[model samples]
Target chain A: MLATTIHGPRDIRVEEVPDPTIKRPTDAIVRVVAGCVCGSDLWPYRGENPIQAGATIGHECIGVVEEVGGDVQQFRPGDFVIVPFCHCDNTCAHCEAGVQSACDNLSMTTSGQGELARVGQADGSLVAVDGGAPDAALVPSLLALTDVMPTGWHAAVSAGVAKGGSVVVVGDGAVGLCGVLAASVMGAETIIAMSRHEDRQRLATDFGATHVVAERDRAGAKAVKEITGGVGADAVLECVGTDQSMGTAFAVARPGATVGFVGVPHGVELPVGKMFQKNVALRGGIAPVRRYLPELLELVLDGRIDPGRVFDLTLPLADAPEAYRAMDERRAIKVLLQP
Target chain B: MLATTIHGPRDIRVEEVPDPTIKRPTDAIVRVVAGCVCGSDLWPYRGENPIQAGATIGHECIGVVEEVGGDVQQFRPGDFVIVPFCHCDNTCAHCEAGVQSACDNLSMTTSGQGELARVGQADGSLVAVDGGAPDAALVPSLLALTDVMPTGWHAAVSAGVAKGGSVVVVGDGAVGLCGVLAASVMGAETIIAMSRHEDRQRLATDFGATHVVAERDRAGAKAVKEITGGVGADAVLECVGTDQSMGTAFAVARPGATVGFVGVPHGVELPVGKMFQKNVALRGGIAPVRRYLPELLELVLDGRIDPGRVFDLTLPLADAPEAYRAMDERRAIKVLLQP
Candidate 1:
C-alpha cells in the first residue's frame, strides 16, 4: 500500500507502506476510495506545527470495508462507509451525551490517505452507506461528511443558529463556507461571510451567504454591524482560529449571542472581559463529526446539499506533495485525492 | 442624608452627604429600606479594585419610591421596589433580547447604601412589589433579589442547568450559596457546594447543597468527580472570578458541559486548548439582573426560596463602616444595612 507521509516541513511523499490488518476484534480494514487535504494539514507543511521524521497524515476519507474483526457487528466487508476523523466507542458517557470528540476511548484516523487503513471501534465509528456504493459523482460529498461538513454543522449548532436568526461566519475557507451552508440549512435568514479573497467570497455567496465583507479586523466587524442594522449578528461562527479572527467574531456578536469556534486554536487568547461585559458566550471545539455523520450523509445522498463543491482540486495519490503545496499556497480551497 | 463612603483602602465611613434627587426624566428617587454589603463591595474596600476618594459605594438595595421624574412610568411614589445593581432602559435591543446588563443606555447604581438614592432608567431597572410595601421580614429577601439572587440565577441558567442534572458550585460567597439555591430550584438532582468554612457549608446545606466538598484546587475537583461517579457534574457555576476557581469549574465539568461564571473577573485566563479538546464551554458575565427580577421576586414573595438568608449579619446605618469590615474580614457571609 502507498500512503502519504511527512518527513519535515514541506516534505510530503507517497511511499510504499505495509498493508493494514485487523489488529483488534472491533477493528476493520478499509480500502480508501477518496481522501482530502485539510486546512489543518498546512500546519505541518508550513512548519507551523511540529512533526515527526515520518508520520502518516490525513484524517478524512470515504472507503469500502475490506475486512472486519470478529467483534464488529454493524459493519462487514463490501460495505461503503464514511470514516469520522476521530474514532469513538459511541457508548461512553461523553459519546452518549453527543460529544464523541471527547470520548473516553478516542483515537484519530491518521492513515486515511493510504490505499488501505485500519479503523478501530468499527461498530461505533463507521457509518455505512445503505444499499451499497452510490454513483461516483456523489463520492466527494459523501467523503465530506467524514469531517468538514459535520464540523461546519457543529459550529452552527454550537453558535445557536436558529430559524430567522442572523449569522456571521468568519473565515472564508472551505470550512467557513460550509458553516455558511450549515447556517442556511439551520434556517438562518441573514448569512454574512467575511472574506478577503474573490474566489472564496464567490463560493461563500453561492453557499447561501447573503452578504460578504472583504475587510479584515475592525473594518470587517464594522461592516457586519452595519449589515445587521447597527446591532451585531445573532450568532457568529469562528472558523479561523487566529487572534484577529476571534477578535472580529466577538466584536460582531450582539449581547447574548454565542461564538462557535471550529478552527484549532493557535495563539488565540479569549477576550474574557469583553465577553462578560457584552454577555457574549464562547462554545465549540473538536467537532463530534461521528454524531453528525448519519444525518449529514442523508442530506448529501438526498441532494439537499452539495458540500463536495468545496473540493476545488483533485489529485492522484502519487501527487500527494502537489496537493499539500496547492492548499498551503492558497491555490485551492480543498484538494480531493483518489487512492 | 447619611451615606457610606470610601476614602481609600480600609477607610469605609458613614458621613453626611447631599440627599439624592431626580436627576433625569427617566430617574426615580428611592428612600433606602435595606442595603446589603456585597462580595464585590469587598473588592473596592480591600483596594483590589480602584476606588475614588469619598465615593459613595453600594449597588444592592430594596427601597420605597420617594419621587419620580416625568418620564418614569412604571414606578410611583410610596411603592416599594428592588433596584438592580445595573440600571437599564429595558427597551434597547440588548434589553429586549433579555440582556439588560448590556443595555444601550446602561448605568450603575452607586448610592444604594444612602438614605436616598437616584436610580436611572427607573421604568426598566426597578421591579416593584405588587400591592405596596410588605412586611419588614420580607425586605431582606427582596433586597437579595436586587443582585445576588438574580446573579446566581443567571449563573444557573447560563450553565444550562436542567431537571435531574447534577451541579457543582465553585465559590462559597453569598452569590455561590444563592447559586446552590438556584440549581436546586432548577431541579438538579445532585448539588455539590465547595466551601472551606463550616458556617458557609452549613448555610450551603440549608440552601439545598446535597454534598459539600471542602477541598481546594485539584482536590476539590477530584472530590466532585468522585461524587459524580468519575464523570463530573452536568453543569458548573464558577462564582469566584479567579484563575484557580475558573480552572476548577472546567476540571469538574463533564464533557460538553458549560461553566456559568458571574463573579467580577479579577485575573482569569481561560484554558482554551483544554476547553477545545474536552468540548467544555464557558458562559456568563455581569448578570442581567433586571431581566430576572420579576421571576425571582415572585419566588421570594411566595416563600418558595429564602435567598436573603445569605445575609447573616445586620448593622445600623451609622455602623456602615463595620458592615464593610465584617464582609472584608469574611466574618459575615453578607451584611444587611438599614438606613
Candidate 2:
C-alpha cells in the first residue's frame, strides 16, 4: 500500500508500505477512500513541531472497512465510515460524557497516513457513513465530518455562540472558514472573519462571515471593536493557536464573553489578571469530533452546510508531496487526497 | 469616624478618620453596621500583598444608609443593604449580562474600611436587605452575603454545578466551606470537601459535603477519584488561588468537567497542554457578587443556608488589629467587626 511518510522537515513522500492488519480484538483495518492534509501537519513540515524519523503523518480520513477483529460489532467489511481523529473504547466515563477525544483508553490511529490503516477501538472510532459510500461529489464533505467540520462546531459551541449573537473568527485557514460556517449554522447574527489574504477572505464571506478585518494585532482588535460599535464580539473563535491569535481573541471579546479555541496551542499563556478583570471566560481545547458527527453528518447530507468548499486543491495520493507544499505555501486553503 | 487602617505589614489599627460624605451624585454614605476580615485580607496583613502606609482596608460590609446624594434612588436614609466588594454602575453591558463586577465604570469602594463609607454607584452596588435592619444575631449572616457567600456561589455556578452533579471543594477555608454550602444549595448529589483541619472538615459536613478528602496534592486527587469510582468529580470549586490548589482542582475533575475558581490567583499558571489534553475547562474568575446577591440573600433570609457560621470570632471595631491577627494566625475561621 502507498502511504505518506516524513523523513525530516519538508521531506514528505509517498512510498510503498506494508498493508495494515487488525492486530487487536478491538481493531479494524480500513482502506482509506479519502484523506486530507491538516493545518496541524504544517507544524512538522515547517519544522515547528519535532518529528521522529520515518514517521507516518496526517490524521483525517474517510474509509471503507476491509477487515475487522472478531470483537468488533459496530462495523464490518465494505462498510463506509468516517474515522474520527481519536480512537477510543467509547464506553469509558469520558467517552460517555461526550469527550471521546479525551478517552482514557485512547489510541491515536490516524497518524498512519496511508492507503490502508489499522483503526483501534473500531466500534467507537468509526462512524458508518449513512446510505453507504457517498457520491463522488459528497466525498469531500463527508470526509470533512471526520475532523475539521466538527472541530469548527466545537469552537462555536464552546464559545456558547447562540441565536442572534456575534462571533469573531481569528484565523483564515480551513478550520477558521469552517468556524464561520459553524457559527452561522448555530444562528450567530454576525460572523467576523479576520484574514489578510484576499482569497481566504472571500471564502470566509461565502462561508457566512458578515465582516472581514484584514488588520493584524491591535489594529485588528480595533477593527472588530469598531464593527461591533466598541462592544466587541459576543464570542471569538480562535482557530489559530499562536500567542498573537490568542491575544487578538481576548482583545476583541466584550466583557463577560467567551473565547473558544481549537487549534493546538503553542506558547500560549492566558493573562489571568486581565481575563479576571474583564470576566472573560477562555474555554476550549481539543474538539470531541465524535460527539458532533451525527448532527454534522445530517447537516452535510441535507446540504445545510457546504464545508467541503474549504478544499481548494485536490490530487491523487501519489502527489502527497505537492499537497503538503501547496498548503504550506498558502496556495491551497486545504488539499484533498484521493487514495 | 472609626476605620481600619494598615500602617505596615502585620500592623493594623482602628483610629479616627475623616467622616465620609457624598462626593458624587450617585454616591450613598453607609454607616457600616457589620464588617468582616476576609481570607484575601491576609495577603496584605502577611505582606504577601503590598500595602501603602496607612492604607484603609476591609471590603466586606453590611450597613445602613445614613445619607444619599441627589441622584441616588435605590435607597434612602435608614435602609439596610449588602455592599458588594465591587462598585459598578450596574447599567453597563457587562452588568446587564449579570457580570456587574466587571462594569465599565467599576469602582473599588471596599478599600475604605471605615464606619462611614461613601459608596459609588449606590443603585447598582447595594442590594437592600428584605425587611428593615435585622436583629444583631443576623448581622454576621448579612455581612457574609456581601462577598464570601456570593464568591462561593460563583465558583459553583461557573463550574456548571448542575443538579445531581458531584463537586470537589479545593480549599477548607471559609470560602471553601461556603462553596460546600453553595454546591449543596445548587442540588449537587455529591459534594466533596478537601480539608485537613478538623474544624473545617466538620463545618464542611455541616454545610452539606457528602464526602471529605483530607489528603493534599496528587493523593487528594486520587482520593476524589476513588470516591467517584476512578472517575473524577464533575465540578471542582477552586477556593485557594495558589498553584497547588489550582493543580488539585484540575486533577480532581473528570474530562469535560470544569473548575470554577474564585480565590485571588497568586503564582498560578494553568498548564494549557495538560488541560487541553484532558478536555478540562477553567471557567471562574472574580465572582460577580452583585449578580447572585438577590437569590443568595433570599436563601439566607429563608434559612436555607447559614454561611455566616464561618465567622468564628467577632471583635469590636476598636479591636480590629486583633481580628486581623487571629485570621493571620489561623486562630479564627473569619472575624466579624462591629463599628
Candidate 3:
C-alpha cells in the first residue's frame, strides 16, 4: 500500500505502508482514490503546526469501502463515499443541534493515526452517492464535497445569502472560489471575490463571481461600499480566517446584514460593540460538512455547479512535497493527490 | 421655567430661565412634570465628558404640554407625555427600520436650545394615552418608559432572551436593575445581576434577578459558567458601556447565544476575534425608545410592572445638581426629581 508521509518541514515522501484493515466494528477500510491538500494543511506542512514523523497527512479524501466493520450497516464494500473532515458520534445533543463539528464524541486527525480508524459513527460520517462508482473526472468534485464545498456552502448559507442579496467573499483559495459558486447557486444578485492572482480571479469569475476586487478588507470594503451605494454588501463570506479578512467582512456588510466565516480561524476576533450597533450577524465555524453534503452532491451531480475548478495541479501521491510548496507559494489554488 | 444647566464639568446649577414658547409648526412646549438623573448624565456632569456652558443637562423627562404649535394636531393645551432621549423625525429609512435613534432627522439637545424645538414626525415619536393627564402614581413609571424601561426592554429583547433561559446582567445602575425586570417579564428562569452594593442587589432581586454575582466580566464569566454547568449563561445584558462590561458580556454568554447591550458606551471597543470564534451574537445600541413606549405605557398603566423601583432617592427639581452629585458619587442608584 502507498501513503504520503511528512518527515520534516517542506519534506514529504511517498512510502509503502501497511494496508488498512478494519480494527473496530464501526470502522471501514477504504482505498484512497483522490485526496487534496488543503490551505489549512500548509500550516502543518510549513511546520508552523505541530506534526509527528512518518504521519499520513491528508484529511480530505474520496474513497471506496474496501471492507466494512461488523457494526457498519449502511456503508458496504465497493460503494463510493465522501468522508467529512471531523468524525462524530452523531447522537449527542450538540449533533442534534446541527453542530456536528462540536459533537461530544468528536475525533480530529492526528499524525501516526491509522487509516482504518473507527469513524466513531460510520453511518453519520460517510455519505454514499447514488452513482455506482464516480468516474475519474468526478472524483475531485466528490472529494471536495467532503470538506471545501460544504464548507463554502456553509459560509454562504450561514451568512444568509439568498436570492438577490449581494455577497463578498474574502480569500482566493479553494474555499473562496467555491464560495462564489455557492453564492451564485444560492441566487445572490451580486458576488464579489477578492483575489490578487489573475488565474484564481478568472476561475472565481467562472464560478459566478459577478465582480472581482483585488483590494483587501479596507480597500475591498470601500470598493464594495461604493458598489452598493455606500450601504456595504448584504452578505460577506470571510474565508481567510485572519483579522484583516474578518474586519473587511464586518466593514462591507450593511447594517443588519450578516457575515459567514468558515476558515479555521487563527488570530481573528469579533468586535462585539460594532456588531451590536450595526446589527451585523457573525456566524460560521468548522463546517458541519455532513449536514450539507447531500445537497451539495446533488448540485454537483445535476451539473448546476462545478467545484472541481479549484484543483489546479493534480499529481501522483509521490509529489506531495511539490503540492505543499505550490500551495504555500500560491502557485496552485488547490492540488489533488492520487493514491 | 427652571432647569439644570452645566456651565462646566462639576459646575451644574439650578437656574431660572425664560419660559419656553412654540417656535415651529410641529413644536410643543412642555412644563416638565418630572425629570431624573441618568447614569449617562453623570458622564458630562463629572467632567468626564465635555459640557458647553449652560447646556440643558437632563434628557429623561415626563412633561405636560403647556402649548402646541399651529401644525401640532395630536395634542392641545394639556396632555402628559413621555419624551424620549432621542428626538427622531421617524420618516427616514433608518427610522422605518425601527432604529429611530439613527434617523436622518434626529436632534440632540444643545446648549441654550429653547424647549419649543420641533419634534419631527411627532405622530410616530409621541404615543398618546387616553387620559389628558397621567396618574401621579404612574409618573415615575412613565418617566422610566421614556428611557430606562424601554432601553432595558431593548436589551433583553435584542439579547434574544426567552422564557426559561438563563440571563446575566453586568451593571447595577437603574437601567441594569430595570433590565432584571425586563428579563423577568420575558420569563428568564435564571437572572444573575452583578452588583457590589447590597441595596442595589436587593432591588435587583426584587426586579426579578434570581442570582447575584458581584464580579465583573472575567470572574463573572467563571461564576456564570459555574452556575450553568460550565456552559456559560444563555444570555447576558450589558448595562455598563465600558471595555470591562463589554468583555464581561462576551465572556458570560455561551456559544451561539446573544448578548444585549443598552448602556451608553463611554470608552468601549469590542474584541472581534474572540466573539467570532465563540459564535456569540452582539446586539443592541441606543434603544429606539418609541418602539416600546406604547407597550410599556400599557404595562405601567395596568400596574402590571413598576419601573419606579429604580429610583431610590427623590429630590425637588431645584435640587437637580445635588441629585447629579449623589448619582456621580454612587450614593443614589437613581434620583427622581419631582417638579
Candidate 4:
C-alpha cells in the first residue's frame, strides 16, 4: 500500500507501507478511495509544528470498509462510509453531549493519505453513505463530509448565527469558504467573507458571501463595521487562528454578539478585559465531525450545497508531495488525492 | 445630603454632599430607602482597584422616585423602584438585545449611599414594584435586586444552567450566595457551593446549595468532580474574578459545558489550549442588571426568594465607614446602609 509520510520540513514522500488490518475488537480496515491535503498539514511542513521523521500523514477520507472487527456492529466489509477525522467511543458523556471530539476514549485517526487505514471504534466513527457510493463526480463532496464542512458548520452554530442574522467570516481558506456556505445554509441574511486574494475572494462570493473585505488587521475590522452600519455583524466566525484574525473577529462583532472559532489556535491570547467590556461570547473548538455527518451527507447527496468545489486541484497518490506544495503555495484552495 | 465618599484607600466617610437633581432629559432623582455596600466597593477601599479622592461610593439601592425629567416616561415621582446599578439607554442595539450594561449610552449610577442619587436613562434603569411600595421590612430584599441578585442571575443564566442539570457555584461573596439562590430558582438539580468560610457556607446552604464543598483551588475542583461521579458539573458559575477561581470553574465543568462569570475580572487569563481541548465554552461579562430586574423583583415581592438575608449587618448612614470596615474584615457577608 502506498502512503504519504513526512521525513522533515517540506519533505513529504509517497512510499510503500504495510496495508492496515483490524487489530482491535472495535476496529475496521478501510480501503481509502479518496483523501485530501489539509491546510493544517502545512504546520509541520513549514516547521511551525514539529513532525516525527516518518509519520504517516492525512486525516480526512471517504472509503469502503475492507474488513470489520467482531465488535463493530454498525459497519461491515463492502460498505461505503465517511471516516471522521477523530475516533471516539460515542457512548461517553462528552460524546453523548454531541462533543465527540472530546470523547473519553479519543484518538486522532489520521491515515487517510494512505491506500488503506485502520479505523478504531468503528461502530461509532463510521457514517455509511445511504445506499452505496455515489458517482465519481460526487466523491470530493462526500469526502468533505469528513471534516471541513462540519468544522465550518460548527463555527456557524457556535456563534449563534440565526435565521436572518448577519455573519462576518474571517479567513479565506477552504474552511472559511465553507463557513460562508454554512452560515448561508443556516439562514443568515448577510454573509461577509474577508479575503485578500482574488481567487479565494471569488470562491467566497460564489459560496454565498454577501460582502467581502480584503483589508487586514484593524483596517479590516473597520471595513466590516462600515459595511454593517457601524454596529458590526451579528456573528463573527474566526476561521483563522492567528492573533490578527482573532482580534478582527472580536472587533467586528456587535457588543452582544458571539465569535465562533474552529481554527487551531496558535500564539493567540484573549484579552479578558476587552472581551468582557464588549460582552462578546466566544465558543468553538474542534468540530464533532461524526455528529454532523448524517445531515451534511444528506445535503451533499441532495445537491443542496456544493462544498466539493473547494477542491481546486486533484492528483494521484504518487504525487502527494506536489499536492502539499500546491496548497502550501496558495495555488489550490484545497487538494484532493485519489488512492 | 449625607453621602458616602472615599477620600483615599481605607478612608470611607459619610459627609454632607450636594444633593442630586435631574441633570438630563433622561434622568430622574431618587431618594434612596435602602442601600448596600458591595464586595466590589471594597476593591478600592482595600486599595486593590485604585480610587480617586472624593469619589461617591455605593451603586446598589432601592428608592422612591422623587423627580423625573421630561423624557423619563417609564418612571415618575413617588414610584418605589429598583435602580439598576448600571444605567443604559434601552433604545440602543445592545440594550435591545438584553445586554443593557453594554449599551452605547451607558453610565454607572452610583451615589446610592447618599440620601438622593441621580438615575441616568431613567426609563431604562428603573423597574417599579407592583402595587406600589411594600412593607419597610422588604427594603433589604429590594436593594438586593439592584446589583447582586441580578449579577448572580447573570452568572447562572450565562452558564446555561438548565432544569435537571448540575451546577457548581464558585465564590462565597454576596454575588456567589445570590448565585446559589439563582441556580435553585433555575431548577438545577444539584447545586454545589464552594466556600471556605463557615458563615458563607451556611448562607450557601440556606440559599439551596444541595452540597457544600469547603475547599479552595484544586481540592475544591476535586470535591466537585467526586460529587458528580467524576463527570463534572453541567455548568459552573464563576462569581470570583481571580485567576484561581476562574481555573476552578473550568476544572469542575464537563466537556461542552459553559462557564458563566460575573465577577469583575482582576487577574484572569484564560488558557485557550486547555479550554479548547476540553471543549468548554466560556461566556459571561458584567451582568445586564437592568434586563433582569423585573423578573427578580417579582420573585422577591412574591417571597419566593430572600436574597436580602445576605446582608447580615445593617447600620445607619452615619456609620458608613464602619460598614466598609466590617465587609473588608469579613465580619459581614454583606452590609446595608440606611439614611
Backbone clashes in model 2, listed as residue pairs = none
Per-residue CA lDDT of candidate 3, range A214-288, in tens?
987577778988887766787889898777778888888876677888887766656655776676767777777
Predicted model with the maximum lDDT: 1
Worst 10-residue lDDT window, candidate 2 chain B: B105-114
**Candidate 2 per-residue C-alpha lDDT over A94-185 given as tens digits, one digit per residue, 9 for 90 to 100:** 89999888888787755446898788899988889767888999988987887889989998988899999999999999999999999999
lDDT of 4 by residue, B1-339 (tens): 999999889999999888887779999999998988999998899889988899789998888999999998887789988899999888888898888988888988679898999999988878888667788888888889999999999999989999999999999999999999999999999999998899999989989999999888888888999999889999999998999999999899888888998888898988787777777888889889988887888898889999999999999989999999999999998999999
Candidate order by lDDT, decreasing, is: 1, 4, 2, 3
Question: Local error of candidate 1 at A161, Å?
Answer: 0.3
Better of 1 and 3 by TM-score: 1
TM-score of 4: 0.98
Q: Write the per-residue lDDT of candidate 4 for residues A6-70, one digit (tens) a residue.
A: 99999999998777777889999899999999877888999988799888999999899999999
> Which scores greater on TM-score, model 2 or model 3?
2
**What's model 3's overall lDDT?**
0.77
Please provide, for model 2 over B1-339, each residue's C-alpha lDDT reduced to its tens digit, 9 standing for 90 to 100. 889999888999888878877889999988888888889988888888878888689888888899999999879999998898888888988888888887887776554357878788999899897688897777777889888999999989889999999999999888999999999998999999999989888999999999999999989988999999898989999999998999999899998888898888888888777777877877777888888988988888888888999999988888989998888878899999888
RMSD of each: 0.9, 1.3, 4.1, 1.4
List the candidate 4 regions with Cα displacement exceeding 4 Å.
none
lDDT of 3 by residue, B1-339 (tens): 667788888887877766655556766666666778888887887777877787676777777667777777777666767777777766666676677776666654321112322244454566665776777777778878878998888889878889999999889999999899999999999999999899999999988988999876577778888887776777889988888888888888776677788886777766655655555656677788887788888888888899987888888877877887898888998888876
Q: What shift in Å separates residue A335 of candidate 2 from its native position after superposition?
A: 0.8
**Which has the better lDDT: candidate 2, or candidate 3?**
2
